[model samples]
Target: MEFTETLLPGVGVRYDGQSRDGQPIAIVVAHDGDVEIVTYQRTDPDAVQYRLELAAHAALAVAELLGSPRVSARLVDLTREIPGLHTRRLVVAPGSRYAGRLLGDSKARTRTGCSIVAVVRGPDVIAAPAPDFTLLAGDTLIAIGSERGLEALAELLGLTPDDPVPVMTAPV
Candidate 1:
């Protein structure tokens, strides 16, 4: 989708875009960390149908809820080009054996044939993380491999074969 951003002078910034369904939507962020979400009427783009005002913290929470599914969908799309390849985001749960260990020490690639493409630690995304990268509790490991390889990698990460993969929800 295309978006237009405008400076609101002393007020803040306004971002306007059209949704996939052709409905107009806007977000206005004030200088004081307040946010306004505006949705225009379907019949008249210029007419406001709904508006939501939120503080910075509430906006962040909403963003997280909406953004994670999109990210997960994109990851699945990326792996579609390669046959027999799958991508999964595995979390490093507390009490797991891999926590506080170096990526090289895990030998996940050598043993399971899965590759750790990135590591997500809170708000930071370490792309193409090196072998020296340290695994920690609450870290999200982005792994790409075959189905069997991914299962093996989960086993190596101290998960049981029956354990459900902890990651973003799968795309519908």
Candidate 2:
């Protein structure tokens, strides 16, 4: 589906699109993290059907439920916005060496030139985790760097380079 973005100037940005079923929908993202989801009546395009508003934090919780694919999609969009940079999700397995080790122990950033921007542990997201933070099994590390750096980081984490890592960018 295609979406049209309209800048609200003093407010925020609005994205207008049609749902797969041909329902008119508009998503407005405010500067302060408020989100408004508006749907229009099918019979009367200009008439309102219903509107749902979500606070920033709430929207994030919803996003988590929607899973990492959506996040990856956004990351793919990010890759398009910035040339050459890439993002990938690395899952820490139960048998991995870094399963119970500190973040600094892997020296991931220094060794692979990739920064672990966030760690998704279950329902919680640890943003910009410090080196002292302990990594647990099942923790999904969100890292950003050059593609080769990402591959190196995966290797450093004891994970095979081809093990389900969602490459954020297509082959160029």
Candidate 3:
């Protein structure tokens, strides 16, 4: 989908786009962190059907809910472009050996050939995290590597070969 962005001078900005079904949609954010979402009628795209306004925090929550899956899919596609490369989302379980350790301490990349590209903690996404980033229990790690490398990384994260890697899901 193509999005058109317009600056609102002293105000924040406005972003407009059309849904796959051809309905016009827009989001206008104010400088004070207020977000207004406008939906146009399907029958007449120029007609405003509804408008929902939300606080900055609420808008961020909604965005994350709607965007996480797409981000994961894009990551997978990027990895697939290179031969023998793969992408996996691994959660740090409570009992995992690396649960409370720093990423650099685990030397995951050196030991398993897998590099962590992002860390999903609650509603926040830390992309290209540094080695000093802590790996806490319940954090979902986005790692990229070869199949064998991913398996090794999983083992290092305290997951057995028989354990099924959970698919990346929107954070609660």
Global lDDT scores for all candidate models: 0.76, 0.79, 0.78
> What clash pairs does model 2 have?
none
Per-residue alpha-carbon lDDT of candidate 1 for residues 54-134, written as tens digits (9 for 90 to 100) = 997787678667643224334665786677889987888777777888888777887788888878787777877888889
lDDT of 2: 0.79
Comparison by TM-score, 1 against 3, better one: 3
Candidate 3: deviation at residue 84, Å? 0.8
Off by over 4 Å in 3: 1-69, 159-172
Q: Could you tell me how far off, in angstroms, the CA of residue 120 lies in candidate 1 after the best superposition?
A: 0.7
User: 1-172, model 3: which lDDT tens digit per residue?
Assistant: 5568888998887889977778779989786667899998768877779999999778767777875533554675587478788898888889887777798876788777788999988778888889889989999899998888888777778853355643432211
After superposition, the stretches of candidate 1 with alpha carbons farther than 4 Å from their true spots are 1-73, 159-172
Candidate 2 lDDT trough over 10 residues, lowest sum: 163-172
TM-score of each: 0.52, 0.54, 0.54
What TM-score should be assigned to candidate 1? Answer: 0.52
Candidate ranking (lDDT, best to worst)? 2, 3, 1
Q: Against the true structure, what is every candidate's RMSD?
A: 12.8, 8.7, 11.9
Candidate 1 residue 159 Cα shift, in angstroms, is 5.6
